[model samples]
Target: MRRVQRVPLDEAARQYLCERQQYARRLLAEDRLRAARFWKDMRETAVFTPVLTALEQMAGPRRRCMYCLDSRGSDVEHFRPKASYPHRMCSWRNLLLCCSDCGRKKGDRFPLDDQGLPLLLDPSADEPWEHLDFDPETGNLTPRFDPTGASSPRGEETVRMLELDQREELALGYQTTYKRLKRELEVALSAGPLDPSALRERLEEADDHGLLPWCLRYGGSTLAPFSTLRQEHPAVWAALSEAV
Candidate 1:
């Protein structure tokens, strides 16, 4: 998954959320809160609608799921399950946009490390490429392995929890996006040295699944067309990388 750029909510919405969070925290402290029911009721209110809109804006034009980036982000997901962390129930950073499938699969299951840190990747907060690696051949995401051959525990847990490597449709969508990105580079390279700005624009437009960062900066950089560009024209490669 690509890193999501979190957008700020309006002052009114932020105040509303803060007030609601205080209410939740109070009830939770008293052991009187039913997290699911409380959130469900608040979700239908006018005040909460703005939060969803802001999340959609963060997901970009396609409104893709923050986790998979494939389906429309229809649900406002709690990064830390509200039932478990009621104090963060209405915190802006604790919310994310997710597809119905992912929402269902993830439910309220949140795993944590020994120190009580989240084992899952927070796309808005974490750099995905640092933990997750793309496999162009299978179009499946795997935990990134370090030079020491140790895989990222967070990435492994995230993939397993979200079933990132098992979804056939998700894999296909990633493959299609990868191919499109590859083609853009191939076409640019074939046309002989072209303006880096134009090429960067084309690549960004074609990067529907947000694979440009992976293709341009990470593992995909070592693959064909991209590697060729880097080798043959280091200056253009630097420009393209800087732009993306």
Candidate 2:
């Protein structure tokens, strides 16, 4: 999961949402006819436009599933499943853009922890790499280990629920990105005289899975090339560390 940039809704869309919200409120208040009219408009626009807009914001050269950040993100997903959380069916924060594979894997499973926090990370609200770690060599995601050696429960649950480790296709996708990133870094290191800024920009361009954060901040500290960079090139390591 990565940081999802939330696009502001246009004025016309905002007005439409206001009208729809009022309609839902009226329906909740027992105005059946009015509520139905509002629901109809809400469904039309909510199902029709917002999803399209979400896709527009989510896709780019590094398009990915909003939830798993593994597969190709292909469609808009409701953060609150329409069937289970119908009241939020049209809410903005309740919607996410995702790939068909993630959509299928997620289905309607929205588990909550004892503290009422969602087990899954909302990429829009949280950075997923914080709780998760990726092994580029294996292309399997694992729960982040704390200083105490205990794994993050949230990350573990998410990996298991989405089968982030077991999914062969997703693993291959990550592996491809991982290999590309490693190659880029290795070239930077071997070039004898490295320009840190230019190298950082190049690495940023190559990063597709938002793995840079996990690499520089977490993955870099222990893992191979990152570790080698950390020990050999302190300035480059520091710059990359802050870049993420």
Candidate 3:
């Protein structure tokens, strides 16, 4: 998953969320809250429409799932399970856009560390590439290895929860995007001295699965096309890296 740049909600939307939170808080305090009912009610409200729209906006034009970035994000997901954290039921920061498959897979399963920190990566709050590693050959996402040769616990949990490494369709999608990105770079390199701005725009257009950040920051830089560019044209690589 890519690091999502969360766009702030408008004053009206913020007010709506605040009111909903207050309502939820009261219900929770009285021990009268039913998580499913509360969420259903929220979805029926007029204010919740704008919240859904805002989430879709954050997911980009295709409305890709925040977790997999493969399927179309069809619903608003609760980062913290609503049944367990009713007080945060309507909190904006607790919401995300997700595909139905991911939503089902992640239902009510929130894992925590020894220190009580969430083991799952919050795309809006954390940089996923830091914890997750991508395999260009298999198009599978696995836990990033640490200096000690162990996988990142958070990444491992996130991948397991979302089944990122096992989904056939997801793997195919990632592979297709990787090939497209590789072809774009190769073509640019063959064309001679690169125009940084033009190259950036072209790559961004071709990066349908948000692989550019992974390519630039992680193991991708050591691979073909990227490695060749970095070695032969340091100036161009620097410019491209900065722009992405």
Candidate 4:
């Protein structure tokens, strides 16, 4: 998953959400809140339409799932399960765009640490690569190993929660995106001195699965053609990484 920059809602949309939150709060106080019914009503509102559009825009042209970044995001997913956290049901920050598969798999299963912090990665709030690692060979996502040789708990939980390692179709999609990026880098390398802006544009276009960040910032640095670029062209690598 990529780090999704949460976009701000316009004044009108923000006001609508604030009103919805007040309604949700009232229902919750009376213990009469039903998450499904509340969301169904909210979904029918004109203001809610803009919220969905904003989420789609955040997912780019494909509008891929926020959790997997694979498959089309067709529905609004509750980051904090609405059933469990009714107060946040209408909260803008608690919503995300997700695919049906991910929605089904993640249904109401919110795990938390001892401190009551969520164990699952929040793409909009956290950098996934910090906890997760990619295997270029197997095309599976796994927990990054820490300096102490223990797998990152958050990464492990996220992978397990999303079944990132077991899904065949997801792995294939990630592999395809990785190869496309690799090929682009190889072609750029063969063409001598790099034009920083041009290379950035090309990589951004090719990065459908959000692997570019992983390549430049994390485990991908040790892998080729990234490794070759880093060693053979330090200045270019620096410039490219910075631009990305």
Give me the runs in candidate 2 sitting further than 4 Å from their true place.
28-51
> RMSD in angstroms, candidate 2?
3.2
RMSD (Å) of each candidate, 1 decimal: 1.1, 3.2, 1.0, 1.0
Q: What are the Cα lDDT values of the candidates?
A: 0.90, 0.74, 0.90, 0.89
Clashing pairs in 3: none
**Per-residue lDDT tens digits of candidate 1, residues 5-102?**
88889999999999998998888879889988999999999988889999989999899999999899999999998877888999999999999999
lDDT per residue, candidate 3, 95-184, as tens digits?
999999999999999999999999999999998989999998899999999889998999999999999999999999989999998899
Query: Which pairs clash (backbone N, Cα, C closer than 3 Å) in model 1?
Result: none
Candidate 1: count the clashes.
Answer: 0
Cα-based lDDT at residue 3, candidate 4:
84
Q: What residue runs in model 4 are displaced by over 4 Å at the alpha carbon?
A: none
User: Residue 127: error of model 4 in Å?
Assistant: 0.6
